[model samples]
Target: MVSKTIQTASPYLEGVYQPVLEEITARDLTVMGEIPRDLNGLFAHNGANPRFPPGAGHSWFDGDGMVHGIELNDGDAIFRSRFIKTQGLAEDLKAGEATYVGSLAMPGQGKRHKNVANTDLVYHSGKFLALWWEGGTPHELTLPDLETRGTFDYQNTLTGGLTSHSKLDPRTGELFFISWAPKPPFLNIGVASEDGRITRFSEVPLPGPRVQHDMALSDRYIGVFDFPLMMDFKRPDQKALGFVLDDETPARIALVDRKDESAAIKWFDIKPCFMWHISSAWDEGYEFVLVGARLDGATRHTKSGAILDDLPLVDGEHRFDSHPYMWRLNTRTGAVTERQLDDSFVEFPRVNDHHICSGARYSYMARIDINQPTLEAQGIYKYDLATGSRTDLKLPMHHIASEMSFAPRDGAKREDDGYLIGFVTDKQRMTSEFWITPADSIEDGPVARIKLPQRVPPKFHGRWVDAEAFRTA
Candidate 1:
């Protein structure tokens, strides 16, 4: 059965998203436009690549992990790609096939699960971590070579799992993430120290299991969005994922102080919505503002062996789509004031890491083609939060882009005075290139278009790692 959303035998295995087998380390790569000499760093991306032929019940979330790195220094480029070599990928290699079920798989297929370790990469505790989207063990991988070392657990203090969209405070070197379960201790929040030790960890009270894809962290507080997208693994619905969207309970947002453990985690009632990612958060003089892309209803994504085209399009399309929105919580009176920021459909909103959790002036996001079934970006957007101005770096027709990462210029004093780096592929020509667009003048398009040896499939998330990171302990 063809996927309605992707319109293929398996959406994960077609077009630009298809996985490649050969891992190569090619140096002195060809460049179309001149690379900036001052822009010296690694543009690293983490993605999924199945080692062997998966079963009919295969899901993209369960694909084996892979990492790709493109290093730039003094106008020279080096390209490297390697599989993450997770224990799950090892098990599949030993069996000569995929042998694990996942949260997106058919119910009762098997109890065995694999932490696919393919969604994101975070440089924390002086090491690169390949994170899985299912909130499980993170595998440590080296940069430039992209070699997987082993799973990390913060000295065994992080027991069950870890979040993929974990936020790192650059000023304090504290990593903030979350953990959720189906049973008691339904949710856990953790803050890790610079030495890779879990310093402050506590359980947030919740009645049932939830899929908190991302959280909001600021200088003063941590914000958790508790949507009504409840989980029921035993549900018999083949059309929907293994869960029930509980419409009875209104969604809630919880806020807790970062330093004060005695401060109770307070839950504020809000209208029901499903938000997969939060762009940025900041502490105003009197209010805490959390901004993100929000869909005004529950979202049921793809499941194993299920055909999405068979589902009702009207009920699924807009329900799964999202828009930029903001919510402000008054510290004095516990009041919530929210409003829509823009009308454009976008996702993966990001700001400069140096301005993270601080008052950032601009946000970079992918402008999606709402007509497409999958989340494919037609262009990139630079939305100004301070002046309500918008700048778009539009790609040509039939060209798609991946998530963009902001890199501050070597001597950049302002927040948006840098470049945006991401991968772009032309579907018609079957060619992929790394584009570097000026952040301040994004409408000018790319200054450098580095040609790649291999097609970079649309991965989940990536980061700009400075050359200084390699010298750290």
Candidate 2:
């Protein structure tokens, strides 16, 4: 959608003042919702059957899944993992069986329509909570429906916003989630108390109505960044010219002063441009923030015009590595230093609030050894806080992963590194599996690969919920 304001040449300015100000006008831009239409013919069978396609081909909705948080409490495996079953349904439909709801396809490919919907189970204040980003209002599961113990709705209030990512404070046990408003286009940071009442709400600023894909927490402040949102409603041949190059852009980061809650606060910006998915950690008493930036500014919508030229593969030879950089943001001085990674870097960087696990989209085939025979360039680039050194391990290129969780080893303190758990996908099959790799040992293939019963689509973000805390027995 075009923004509400536009600027052009004006006769009121002379030489120096001419470039200083451009004539500005307000235009109402219409934005639409990307709602999924229900298809009558598709089957929703829960059981795995030859007739039913694997989770890959619309079995479970093709979208990201919230993680089954870390199992901290003692209990059986079922309650511990917090794996919510993907509800399945199946039916045969004739010509009129499926209804075309509308199109989510950008104006590009004749505007093809989207077919599925997504709803997820999130854990907050010690129980499983539900939220859906679709058209309907956000809903919550009742107390009787909760499989775990603990009080929710602390302030007897229900807070609603776009809940894509969240984190639980280890010390306070408070929940902080990233939310966004669709109608008015405002970002939000909401805090839910240990008892489940939302005590605070902070409005975060971003350029547009965007998805808060990733966030990192520090001892003093919460750092947030905005992800770019664009669609190709126009033909593929005309997509290159469809972007906003204006100078007035909105700021993405809002530094909330946890120390002074008395209305006076300060915010810091490392001046990241058109970036998405940031990871940060507190290492050796210093807070560091790292962000991934794509320079082209072109989005997946660019692929909508794929049929016109070449179909844009996810791993297409596009400008993936142009603006990717890793910066160290000083929490004390609010100063930032930088290092540039190879251009092809696009995967999410995993951090443990101390160390940054930088992954690169390149690999060496001969030197590194792993269980899989296939070559993997998507190696985990390890960074040490104390020494400031880096290492690379070839985990095999096909292992696409995100939402990495670091757990302490040998029942040590929560701050220590133990094991790393992440959801990985085998791109060939579009299948997802749980991987267990040591946080310190990058040399090993995930110690265990717990394969899912069916193909699971790639997901965005998740938290580690302690299983022991949710056991009914």
Candidate 3:
């Protein structure tokens, strides 16, 4: 029940002493039920030695729900954002290969340490760049191989409290991110120019800890939002269960001119808003941004005294649950719209012109609006903007879907209609599901659904590899 793929280059903690592996019997470690139920069960059995683990810090890691995508370059260079684990404290540190000990303190002790899993990393321009949340700082590694580089933190201090999600602009080769602080409470949509400089960092006043999740960019402007109250680090004691029982906070979409950084960012008044993964595309008349928010709380079925109770709760009686909705954002007039699907979802969203695509859980569709909630199906769903129509393909109950991408059709660029590609799982058979669907429409169903020979467990995100690029290690 341990991971075999992860290997270190130099001497790690395993070198300091004889590394011992033991089976976790008696379930001493408290399970907060953060990971998806199906994924949690698989990890418990298969035991993943992911590059980064949750409960630690935040980074775009390769584990379940962690967003990682292939940044198309010389062929396909897979890029993932994750918090690199290191041994020792601030002092007494020697850099080399070290076995990652995720927990600094023992389980029984009150101070249970977690690894850093909140940041995002990218491998581009012959270097690995890491972005952390705390300071919105950037850390770079020139070595192509990850192990030899050794772990490091950001050198620059982010002006705001926390740096949320970051996206790379393909056209300009720049980076866009949001910087905000909960204490003083202000948000800014920043642009990191090609020279690795903060070209335009504009601050906008907003309420405390809106905690921007994902953003979409069009030719004219970048659309951002204040996410739902369901997930917030502000009050760890705040109950997630209550947030799910009934939607508490609403999501709002804001527009900012891509060219005019000096102009005050315009706020669009959209209603019932709670989205997670987002992407954007543009046409002549208007710009379209794909956003996945939520229509309702997660469907839960807690036993009278279930194992969930044993796990450490994030806050008061908060059971682990999430629901993300996919919508289209119109920046010109500032209108958010989407087709009404009976089910709820929580996956990243993408757009292919008039068509919007996203990964989904089928169980969400099974729940009757009038009936009580329970765990069931998890699949992929596609929505059309012009028709306000939806198509559902049921995968399985426990399939943990992380992210989705749309590959260019034929030799067309991202601007044109492309094939929709998604990473999915069939945990029951320990199989990987990689399917390609037509971008123009899914009414005819997925063009081709290929199940990989090896089990891919579940993952966070993926990027499309342009055909012309030369991608070899």
Candidate 4:
């Protein structure tokens, strides 16, 4: 019998983080409101769900990858979920226990374990790619049903692995991604065609091993981030992912020309901070605009060993240092100006899929409420970049929502003419619900809420695969 000691000790391993026992498929789910007839696609979320209780020092991010999805067709919803079937998960199942430690616990210690593939999911070339933030090969999954296909290496064309936060160009149907390793030529950038073919792959060397999470893109250039937070694999005492924030290393952005892969990459120096995700970026005249959530200091480690300390404390007494900010870089004068756009605590910023790599009028993000004790978000916030206005769709107390993904309507004309889709977890009831809200009217709440069969644990990122995306693939 499996031991229950670990599950009872860690807060993350209990409650919603507790793993579900079986795969399920349920049809005709209960819906709170009318589902839009035009909203036809699959809302899929990727998260970690450990089958066995994790070992000591395991973080919430250390669990195995499980994908939970809901398919919408002609106003009806069908819910399904499955494990990612990675090599590591296979071994764990065979042993009837967890054999490998997680990134936060073991870091470089467990080199033989399988890549977990648990961070984010993207649909490109009519297939879904499961990704991890710390250098993992992409795992492919079929659309609609989300059946696991296998690992994708672009026909073995990729030298290094892929990053979790790859940028997809909606205008050209090109996928722009970056990867890093612990050696020289440690960083690489590549672009894949719409049909999942490697078109342009190049090595962009960085100073050392740095944690490059997300990249920003415009019509002409792609932005690669090199922040101070990095890993030192050679450190003898290093633990928990080997990440250390070096104040001496300044933050920089490398702008690579998309049209000319061999063009000299321009480097721009910015303030020293850490940004995990980028909402959007675009070029106007000679200035480039980049917007994302920024943290002035490392909040991962607090004086106390509380897991919620990593989150922005919002008790009205302790102000949050992490918030959304906009950075304007002038290419002509080498001048960079940054200003905070919102005071409220927010993260996982996403723009309309149709407006990526270009100017977007609206941005959607998960908002952390002051009343919540955990790090999970309590609501969704929609921000208008043009007027500097914000509207929130607050949830009931203790209810948590995932990162929002904007799905554009068919033959949609305006940028905001789409629906925002995400998963909401009711901790009190130990249930989950898939929600859909019109992008332009987020303040009005979800238009439809389909109850899910199982409680999906807190996850990192997800995507909406339209029916047409499969037809074209």
lDDT score at residue 273, model 3, on the 0-100 scale: 42
> For this target, which candidate reaches the highest TM-score against the unseen true structure?
1
Q: Which of 1 and 3 is ahead in TM-score?
A: 1
Expressed as tens digits, the lDDT of each residue in 1-473 for candidate 1 is: 21213213666677777788889888777777788887887878877777666544456656688777888887788888889888878887787666665445445555445788888888999888988777888899886577888998888987767878888999999989887776678788889899998888788888777777788888998888778676545445554344445666788889889999999887787776778778999999878888888876544432232223432222232243678888888877889888889988888888898777877779898887767756677888898988888999999888898778898777788898889988898888777888888899999999888888888777778888887787343
In order of lDDT, best first, we have 4, 1, 3, 2
> RMSD per prediction, one decimal?
4.0, 16.1, 11.7, 3.9
For model 2, how does the per-residue alpha-carbon lDDT over 287-392 read when each residue is reduced to its tens digit? 4544454333333333223221122312111122333455666667867676655434444444453232222222111111123222122555554534445555
Query: Model 1 — which ten-residue stretch has the worst lDDT?
Result: 310-319
Residue 195, candidate 1: alpha-carbon lDDT: 94
lDDT of 2 at 164: 37
What is candidate 2's CA lDDT for residue 359?
A: 23
TM-score of each: 0.92, 0.58, 0.57, 0.91
| Alpha carbon deviation, residue 469, candidate 4 (Å) | 2.4
Model 2's number of clashes is 29
Runs in model 2 lying further than 4 Å from the true structure: 1-122, 130-156, 205-211, 226-252, 259-272, 283-324, 328-337, 341-346, 353-379, 396-404, 413-416, 423-433, 451-453
lDDT for residue 61 in candidate 4, whole number 0-100: 62
**Model 3 quality (TM-score):** 0.57
- Across 75-130, the per-residue lDDT of candidate 4 in tens digits comes to 99988888888888888889887777655444444433357888889877666899
Ranking by TM-score: 1, 4, 2, 3
